[model samples]
Target: MRADRLISILMMLQMEGRMTAAELARRLEVSERTIYRDMDALSISGVPVYADPGVGGGFVLPANYKMTIGGLTTAEIQAVFMHLAGGSFEQLGIGPPLRSALLKLLHALPDQSRRDAEWIQQRIYLDPESWSQDEKTAPYLQAAQQAIWEQHAVTMTYTSREGHELCLKLKPYGLVAKAGVWFLVGETEGNVRAFRLLRIDSLEGKQEERFVRPEDFDLQVFWQEWLEKYESR
Candidate 1:
């Protein structure tokens, strides 16, 4: 955590040009003495850090001293890389791009920080079932994400547990993940419904019937409304 703070302080100086010790102390939630010690630690560790001892100067890293994702203080990179690898951010399809970005950022980090990043990568992981095994709604989930972004309409063949197959055409509002299941919540026949993705049989989208969503549409409110509908309370 101290290392992370050190990196953040350097980054702030790099971004903000300069800051006073009091300001840094407030931002860091530490004392001025602690800030001084941290500055000393950073300088001793080969970070091009310095403080101007005057009425105007506090602490600053070189203007060119930016925190490259490559130069991250290990834990930062691991947190991001793990999120990408874990399929949590799979919706973006930028997983490989993120990995490459992390590598580029790694190049800017100190040698010790780089080693820490590698160690963190090796230690932490997120292993969820592949989207393909979802059987029922994988395709629909993908479609819903697309529709949410593109403002398109989607049609799906949905089956209830009673084995009734119904064709639904709706304006896709949002895609939500709840309790390991994917739900596509949208307006169907003038009412909102949360359709289980896996239970959706055949899905397709048409580009012609697009409509503008209300500017006030709030996901949290929609979710609460959905819950109310579910309980019939």
Candidate 2:
């Protein structure tokens, strides 16, 4: 969390041009003293950040200074890719930046690291069926996650257990894949619904408009409730 906080601070400074230590602490939910310490750490480590105590001064980095993760070890690089693989690369907004970052990481490695990375990929295989209703749906799981995270609506045709079929436009809230099936939880108009990905005929989404996900919502709680309801049926 500390590392993530530091990265966020740096990025905030980069985006906002300048930010006071108090403001940084408030944003990161840390003490002003901690922000000072983090700033010191960044500056000493060649970050080229500067902070001033005057009324109109705060941390600032040079306009063209770019940070690169081009020195990670093979294991570190592989970890990055493995994390990215957890969701649909096509739909997650982080995918493009991750791909670019991955390329830099791979290019920075030595020849041995590159070979080891390939070996790691070959050996590290996931059994998607155990995680989903069917492994065939794994690729589209990311699509559901993306819609949820972006608050975009999704349109999919799903089949029911009783052999019924329906096409729906859902406000995708979250995705859960377990026991070899994936489910999308969201509301259609004002009704909550869950659809098994394996039964979905086609999936589509657009970001033309978005909605705010509820603040008091928890995916796990919703899931448990759904399970209880299912068992009672």
Candidate 3:
């Protein structure tokens, strides 16, 4: 548990740049003394974590310093690959990278950890498709994903449920995969709408400065509410 706690502190300082001991202790639910001790442990372990002094001072990692994930236990190694093997990575375009990463980790892991991982791999499997339905194809799904990552708008051509060809410029927010279908959630004409990715005939990302995402938008909350209204109809 202390290993996980120390890693958490390391990650927090790495991402947040500077955090007061009080803040770290509060978030980590430990005492300030414990946070300081953990900081020392991290420093001794060769993690470049250091503390600032006086007003607005805390702990920070160097801006350019980063460490790759290593020292994985059997359970950790298993957990990392379970979801990648569960059948969505290909459509999301991350399958190859995940496979390469798994191979790298497997090659470096202890023999027992590798054996445990291989045993689980041979035993447990996952497929997300439904037996009764055909898998839907979304040729533009990757482009939509790109637009979301780029924080840009896209001009998209799609057929509506009523079967009309229409075009709209959408501020792409996120993509959701349900069963075997993908949905593009975006803001268009001052309203957020979910467009079935299969129906989108084309998508062209805007080549402009990054669009500002709304401050209050929460994708998880929005998706859950969307599902409620969608399934009710």
Task: Using lDDT, give the best candidate's number.
Answer: 3
Summarize candidate 2's per-residue lDDT along 11-76 as a digit string, tens digits. 788788889988899779899999999998888878889876688998888888765544446767
Q: What local distance difference test score does each model get? A: 0.75, 0.75, 0.84
What are the runs in model 1 whose C-alpha is more than 4 Å off? 1-78, 88-92, 108-113, 130-137, 220-233
- 26: Cα error in model 2, Å: 9.9
Worst lDDT run of 10 residues, candidate 3, spans 128-137
Candidate 2 contains a number of clashing pairs equal to: 5
lDDT of 3 by residue, 1-233 (tens): 99889878878887888999988998899999999899889899898888789898988899999866656677777787686685566788887898898898778777887888888899888777657544545789899899898898899899998999989999998988876678999999999989999888888989593687896788888999999998998
* Arranged by TM-score, best first: 3, 1, 2
| Model 2 regions lying over 4 Å from their true place | 1-33, 50-61, 84-104, 110-116, 127-135, 138-169, 173-181, 188-194, 199-233
Model 2 is weakest, by summed lDDT over 10 consecutive residues, at: 125-134
Q: State the TM-score for model 3.
A: 0.71
